[model samples]
Target: MKTNSEKTIFEMSVPGRKGFRCAPSDVPAADLPEGLARGALPLPELSELDVVRHYTRLSRLNYSVDGGFYPLGSCTMKYNPKACEKAAAMTGLSALHPLQPIETVQGALLILHETQTILCELGGMAAGSLTPAAGAQAEFCGVKMIAAYLRDQGQTQRKVMLIPDSAHGTNPASSVMCGFACKPVKTNARGNVDLEDLARYCGDELAGIMITNPNTLGLFDENILDVTRMVHEAGGLVYGDGANMNALLGIVKPAALGIDVMHYNLHKTFSTPHGGGGPGAGAVCCVEKLADYLPGPVAAVIEEMTDEEPPVYGLVEPKKSIGMVRAFWGHFAIILRAYVYCMMVGKNGMREIGETATLNANYLMAALKDVYPLPYDRVCMHEFVLDAKWKDAPGIRAFDVAKRMMDYGLHPPTYYFPLIVHEALMIEPTETESKDVLDAFINVMRSIAEEAKTNPELLTNAPVETPFGRLDEVKAAKDLKVAV
Candidate 1:
């Protein structure tokens, strides 16, 4: 079942074929440094059409939001608008150099400033920094800012960071990177922070608590205000993990909920392209108490004139900042896309996004909850976890069901996550998917569940229609290979 397009470009390279033509050198040829050019170039020699066909075929193999449904849980795989892409790709912003003079790149700075302003308003914070490149980086920066603020206030003994058991894996890692000891807080049967556990963990050594609203299980902790109050009583700040901000946009503000700091995933909440390891921007915001400790070079209004002239926008460092977390600010193009997205979806539209996202998730969860057992049977925010232990079989598992999904021309929901549910299949059907698509996915899932009971082998040996059949994933990971 091997295809011609699967062959490496080098495998199809002819001896004397050339894909492109180059004019004779107009200027004098300069020699490369010694030892730089040693042997014949190891490059593919193919015709123009061959090269084009090879890449075109490769692109077809990728499953993206544009291709079909990608309901990756806790990731917010929503569709980004073409208008946002066009705004990001505009020559005036895209073509500007990073090192250009501030006066010349005022427009880009203005976009950054306005974006930060809107983010602060949404999060109910006094200030924000848009320099962290991704969600994880933003978490790291936020934790570091907390550490810096604590140190400045002579609270060196406050070194413990409390993270909920259902929080994302990055929360603890980020806290530890900032020299804080991580303490795991338990989740109750209602899928909320065990208030007793939180009270037990709160002490003089407690630095802060990192909690995700609409947490990984897609349930918002109803006791969030109480949790933050407990932490604050022990002289600790509350850090909100805004990875699930899509569920709270224009609905709830983290600062108003007693969260001292939080990071917004522009990719997840604002419809920027994500997955395949990034090109993302995380907008970090904080209350006035911690604003001075934010990462430096945040976009700000540098000058203002009375009567007629407008305010001059520029980059300025925080008074007692944690220095730069990244080089040359962050992913500017991604930030621009997020800014355009916010503008396109104004205040009312933002509320609609939150409502629709939650509604879609609940709808999908309701349709599939019968075939798959729901861990927390109540209403969900933007996603929910299901136990893939329905069939009374031994070998069939969540991974098997996920691989089988590829056969139906759909990407699988996140499997075995939050570490709380056994054989967890975390599902998040974003607002972008239509009812027809949701019904189709639901029917396919129901059919697969039926097949699991009737013919378990079909689930075990799945993805028969893909480029290749089931593979020994462990062998592939343990033993690596390049040549084919």
Candidate 2:
């Protein structure tokens, strides 16, 4: 097989090729307006075979969770079950239009309502809204709810949102978007939030704190309860970023740990399709105090349940809702997939998901800690970060190691992220991966570490075995190209 194939559809076009012929019109041809007609339309002309083969080859070039081991840390890029996909594709569910009356789409409304109920029960929150498009939007919704609650209590002066230095980049962005000033909280030696520093900021001006439990460092903050207590005592709310919810699935609930409001990444925690900007759902849940301020059109049971018939489910706005954050019901298909995922996993399997994920992460961490320097040497929750800088291979960096992983036919773990670590190579072997696959990944990392010292040039000019060699990533970013 050829290593590289860069032919675009336009490039493969023939002068007068036709993939399909138009059927004869049943009615007479109508004339267009004076300015409506165009002399020519610029489109690729190719045979049906050529089009099919070209797209098929392109699809093969793309990497996915199904393709191989994707240990992208922070992002739980686990294998999505085919059963979820099948449920999402069901004609009874998929065929419904959003504009249909509530009575007509009762099944979908019930699924949405149940999904919200399940998420609330899992996160230990009172109520939730599954309207936010993705995690970031959900974070925004949570922040907005906090702002609304504060404003309602005549605490408009409380405008500061304390974010951890090791938080996802979206945390501060969400806070700012909600008209709150952001303050950075420091991380202690043990990777938990610095209580002393947090105490200093816990004043009337404090609106809340946005914390990621089992944070970006992939370690659960030991001082989480204290962090929340101080903020609450100071009359501020605590917003939990549940991006790493895979770790705490059934083991711990965010609300129990004093989180006033939080968002759950259905795409991450519930094994829905992730990536490609998405069709993602972020179900934002809150304590009873903030529930009324949630994003509108949350699924609810309109009519009470009876002995003979199921309860009537419908979309209802929270009493003091921040208003709709997304168009019509949000990503219904993604929500349906998540609903199916929860049903498939069940209660026992849900707990197992968390346990297995933590186990897999620790297993990988233990195997590679000697070869790669473990930054915060501790038990990681669901993912762990490692420093790629070695004394013997001083010149080799995390970027090189990441690129080199491609040569072994393995997708590289996230590198140069969470910003706190100097040369971070974060890895998360989600619960879906097997022991043999984890061992294979470990062997590849060991081989890469050895290659870094014995054959430094191999790491420098990495991915030589792949179809494309290492690229000028900076140039590719700055000099955008869209055409063939």
Candidate 3:
């Protein structure tokens, strides 16, 4: 609850009691622009405690994965080790500016270089670019590279990209963003990509196909080999959306199993703090053939035979590069965190992360299936999709279930996604969460099911304890604004 003495932003204003003091400017007052500042800025005035308390109260509203079991489907909100966070905050790397002299910031560069190398080996790609700031950006870069490669081969007619119905929505968004036509392929009842639909779309004009293995529904593509072969035979490249890489980190390599290029979301696969928005690192990896077209300036090592000092930064581009996607080699601090995460968990440990993630997800699926309807009943990967039909049948909806989760002091699973499933409740517990946490989460969900049957209103009129009740989503969507 808000304290009795608490003040809103407007209420906090005073005549003049600036908690944050500033020194006089070094520049002459007369040198300032005419209209820059004719009057004093109307800012908040409060004590240090007031400022701290106000912000701390605001921070409490956020339902973070670290705070509870957040099975947010494909987002993979795994626990980011505090040690990785500390390593990223190290003075040497975190304090360095991107524009600093190459020799002065070799440590940062070497970290990125080695991380790229490690990710390449882990994903079975020859080269990688740690430049795209997010997974979607990486997908955009990968798709653009596919377009560039096809355009160079005189296959300008090839402008359509094939994506599965079960693939992440970002697949089509990235495809269309690359200036190519987007074609959606259907998924089989078995929760795998419809290979027939993929073949039907395959042709000379098809640039590439993006597949998320252990896909959105949490089932692995049973015919992955045949699917890749079909795409390759059609003179097209294959790109894997590495969003589900958490499920394949050690079990399989997308590139080795016929994928040509892929993107790795550091925030998802690695131990980076997912800020729920920007500042996530998404590195793109590809084979040697595609290395020339990688976004630059990628980190490169230099030798110093002549003994004045060690050589400086190295950067090279091939014949048909996609150009710079972001300024100054992406988010170095986020990359540092991811690097620390990877190094902390070596090859064997990475495999364990994958294995445990898959095992936990499958276990959760089995535990909850009795109460919730499994859309695709099978052994899942690192996540599974559940249907809300039971809740929907008992006068309860997916939105009600999501809102009710808040009342139970639990975050809700991702709802209404993957498009193919109705009222999709995609859950991915991730390996970081323990079995006890999973059981507790399952119990809350199971309780909701029973409550929905007896006291349907309890679920429908849920989140009674939250600051905000059911949101008017349509109004919020139509009228875009956030409460102050």
Candidate 4:
């Protein structure tokens, strides 16, 4: 049974329908160039009302942070404030072009400059560049800076980047892209980096370590400082993956914890629009030693503040800079949204974001641990991982539970990830959710556990209530059907 929303817009096209019809032209129409003219195009022809209703119905089929609970771990799919959206859409900011004169766009330049400063201050770094387009790009920029710094210091032998088993997959990829060989560091029983394993890899060939605190497993490394010290003592710079910055916010600074450089995912931590192949921003910050190698041009104040005149804000390329990693001055609209988020949250609220996110994750972890097996059973930072392999129902898996979640109208937590844990169901109930929502989610999870034991087939043939039922995922992946 196909739903009304399932029909493609093209399928609804009528022969002579028109959503809009231009009035007869007052001026003479100019003829197009020989190659520019086209015959009839295959666009859908529909009335204005038909188009609006079609899109509205189709939108209801999609899930969003605003629609319901999104417990996607490490991704931080939290509800962003609408006020930030309004700020980003403001005419003065949104209407300005990147090619506009610097003097004419002082307000935007000031915001960009202040945002860079704020990110550096928050991460405890001396300088930063808001030129990287996204978190992955920012990570690339950071690792490249480390490589440049090592080469400049004549330590070209530092070719190894030690990465923990629980680190985000991007860590090793970014290191390799920067020409550094990656070595996997083991995780201890307590979910922290294995100091013994890490120490063995620390040598003259060590480039650095790319660590994600409150790592992908949703646990903070207990021996983080020690780990960084070991690498630093071995003459290796530490590259912190700031994807988990939501868990630290105002609570701790990455640089103070021995991170030489890091990237801030504005989309994840700062509540900018996330996940939909974004116009995202990543602000990369570094200690004074590596500041010169940051990607340029970063926002900066060309002139000092004075009594009579305001300071002049401009873009500056750092000496020995890695050069432009992106077009223009990063994603301005996304950066503007982040700035608004920071200003609105304030200092105390920033701390609250970190604390409440931890509390929420712990709440869910404590509630679900009795049913789902928690691999590293301890207090989690801002997320927790669960092994969704129920011994009572061997047929049920994390993927089944995830699909079943859609039946309850809640988006599933990330499943089978961070690879270290078997059948991992990583959940991060961000600080934005209320207790009522959390309680409802907990109840739903408990019910799912019961169903897994009593009716294993229900778990296997999951998402019966959704628009689409459980699919043959492997076959779907192997032979995709993107369009109808």
Q: Tell me the whole-model lDDT of each prediction, alpha carbons only.
A: 0.91, 0.91, 0.85, 0.91
TM-score of every model? Answer: 0.96, 0.96, 0.92, 0.96
Model 4 lDDT tens row, 1-484:
6554677778777889999989899998888888886877878888998899987877887889989999999889989999999998899888999899899988999999889888988999999999899999999999999999999999999999999988788888899999999999999999999999999988999989999997888888889999999999999999999999999999899999999999999999999878767988989999999999999998888998899999999888999998899988989999999999999999788999999999999999999999998999999999999999987898989999999899899999988889899899999999999999999999999999999999888888888998679778898889987543
Over 4 Å off, model 1: 1-3, 23-34, 474-484
Error of 2 at 320 (Å): 0.7
> What 10-residue stretch in candidate 3 is worst by lDDT?
1-10
Candidate 3 global lDDT: 0.85
Which tens-of-lDDT digit does each residue in 30-85 have in candidate 3? 75688786787656677777778777877887888767778888988999899987
Off by over 4 Å in 4: 1-6, 25-33, 37-39, 472-484
Q: What 10-residue stretch in candidate 4 is worst by lDDT?
A: 1-10
Clashing pairs in 2: none
* Tens-place lDDT digits, model 1, residues 1-484: 5465778887888899998889998999999998998779798898999988988887898999999999899999999999999988789998999899888998999899999999999999999999999999999999999999999889999999999999889999999999999999999999999999899878899998999998999999999999999999999999999999999999999998999999999999999999989988998999999999899789988897568877788888999999898788689999999999999999889888889999999998899888887889899998999888864766789998998999999899999898888898998888888999999999999998888888989999998989878888898779966433
RMSD of each: 1.9, 1.9, 3.0, 1.9
